[model samples]
Target chain A: MDFSSKLLENAVYEMSQLPGIGKRTALRLVLHLLKQPEDQTSRLALALENLRKEIKFCENCHNISDVALCEICSNPRRDKSMVCVVEDIRDVMAIENTSQYKGLYHVLGGKISPMEGVGPQDLTIASLVKKVKLGEIKELIFALSSTMEGDTTNFYIYKQLEGVPVKTSTIARGIAVGDELEYADEVTLGRSILNRIPFENSLKAN
Target chain B: MDFSSKLLENAVYEMSQLPGIGKRTALRLVLHLLKQPEDQTSRLALALENLRKEIKFCENCHNISDVALCEICSNPRRDKSMVCVVEDIRDVMAIENTSQYKGLYHVLGGKISPMEGVGPQDLTIASLVKKVKLGEIKELIFALSSTMEGDTTNFYIYKQLEGVPVKTSTIARGIAVGDELEYADEVTLGRSILNRIPFENSLKAN
Candidate 1:
């Protein structure tokens, strides 16, 4: 689209670089910002700059943090022996929202996706393997998505823990609590049936 | 939603303030930015800040521009006697895209909407009237949306140009070109029927 001002064009170009934002959407957003108070634009810019410049990732879990260790990893009440391994910070946030998992998290940053040219070396796989080899973690929970990349990453990590005595497990693949069985995908339904738990254990909750 | 990092929370909150963006979308955008290289965020922030800090609006037409006078208003080739009055810069851009209009433009900044606490005094109506009173303009085209607020604004401006020796007309309201007659709204179809033009005039080309 032709913009009247170079500044507006530049701003729209930068905004359109964001994921899921197209040229028209970027123009709309830039125009909205132009209509708002100048201070609002300044605040948004400052927040984004500061977030990128000053934000830190936890040394242990690789999750976003204000310090060396993220809140979950630093908390003494969390079960250090039970670590949930996930792809990125969004997964950590999702699990935290559920409030069911009280263990620490190990954010791999991303899955091993060959299509995207992202290998295990590109993620935090080495650090996670080293952590497991240290013998502090007794149970490593694989909480990545049920995709080829997720499975490959999990299997690679499992193989790395060769002689380690830690028990490895994946999150359950089952129909949602309120969802009808007929609506469930065949693969997930089959897996849920094959790995069915005891009738009495199904009723247990934290 | 709870964010583990205060920086992330601040960025997400600021991003969600944009029109049509929600908390979930804001978080997704922020996470995508985090995944990208740091320079991308810095460039986005700098561009937004610079756009707000250094951007200029045309003094005559109130359209966004790099100089005191907008390109359209300063161009000698444009029909200075005919002016299309629009609500905002977006309308100006939309009209420019169509390439059918060869006249100058007057950006009103916004429509007069009492419900939104925006009055005629809040817009650039006074300057527009002043420009018309200068006696250089011979025709004024009202190209605002066919809404209550747009009509009120057009009428208010029309009253301001009383006895100014300028011909006034609104953009035609009818079934859109290449659109089905059955799909046209009742108000538009009714008006199209009542204001039917000469049969031969409908066949005229640009």
Candidate 2:
């Protein structure tokens, strides 16, 4: 960890501050940047600076965007009545890639993880509640992960919408589409069986 | 791989350009940066910029440095007659950490890798040869990794130093200090046996 230059040390230290990158990895990355053309480093630094300073979050869904409202939230074709609530923008991108969901998304930013000192207020829960109270959304799908934190966040939001006339539901928990039943976890397999849709209804989709 | 924002996409793309980092990991890192305070991003960018713009290479050894001459190259106590040639500054740092070597280092910047289109001319081999030709160095130790490229680079440099009044040696290739014979690779184990040192010489070191 003995750096020959203060500049090199500072660069590596800052790079190592990133998640999952160690000092060695930071050094390697910084060395790589040094090896590359100066333009590459300039472009990378500019992109990161611009993204942090100028990037916007969707006012409606809180998803990362270039403008006040993201493309998804502003799109007229997307179903506004059914809003899929997610933990973050990554989840939104994951769902969008599937092209299966026609409804809109409401990103929670993160779950209610008391262990990390991230409570309900830390997320966009209040805005979500206000959106639901406006009565524009008919169905609020809880698309958060099935962890304890995810469950807590979902329940907290559900409680906030008490008697608000919104039909709250959670995403289906089951074996993935192409996964082998034998390899499925016990809880997921059990839930898949318990929540099995009618054979005719399943056939209608495919 | 569709990004919600152009700025986010650019940052992720630039990040993914780093060795071993893919799109998913880049996205994760960019999102983590976004969640952190804006100062973190600014400082990281600034450090990288400053490092790239202001970094210097030692005039004597070509090691990355803040000034024309690195600390090792300028140190009066170091053995100027015995020079250890290495692949890069990382190797220099690794050897320095051992604290066993008192000789100066000559960083070649990189090995001669034909597969990667890196030739001997691309490195500081010519300068090293010039230094050796000047008759200041009594011995030159090759400390590059034991790979085809490393061997090629070493041989190339050795050929360049032909007829020069200097001793040429390579770092010992053998089983690690504490490695078990049973688990050691056959080549290393065999080499270790073939190049066994005198019992008295081994006993001299702690």
TM-score of chain A of each: 0.84, 0.85
lDDT for B166 in candidate 1 is 95
Best-matching candidate per TM-score: 2
What value does the lDDT take at residue B155 in candidate 1? 96
Candidate 2 TM-score, true structure as reference: 0.92
- The sequence of per-residue lDDT tens digits that candidate 1 reaches over residues A30-146 is 989988999999999999999998999999999999899888998999999988888777777666665667789999988898999999899999999899889999888776766
**Over the full model, what C-alpha lDDT does candidate 2 score relative to the true structure?**
0.87
Worst 10 residues of 1 chain B by lDDT: B197-206
**Where in model 1 is the C-alpha error above 4 Å?**
A175-206
Q: After aligning candidate 2 to the native by TM-score, how far in Å is the CA of A67 from where it should be?
A: 1.6
In candidate 2, what are the lDDT values of residues B6-52, reduced to their tens digit? Answer: 99999999999999899988988999999999999999999999998
Candidate 2's C-alpha runs over 4 A off are: A175-206
Candidate 2 per-residue lDDT over residues A86-113, each given as its tens digit: 8888777766765667789999888899
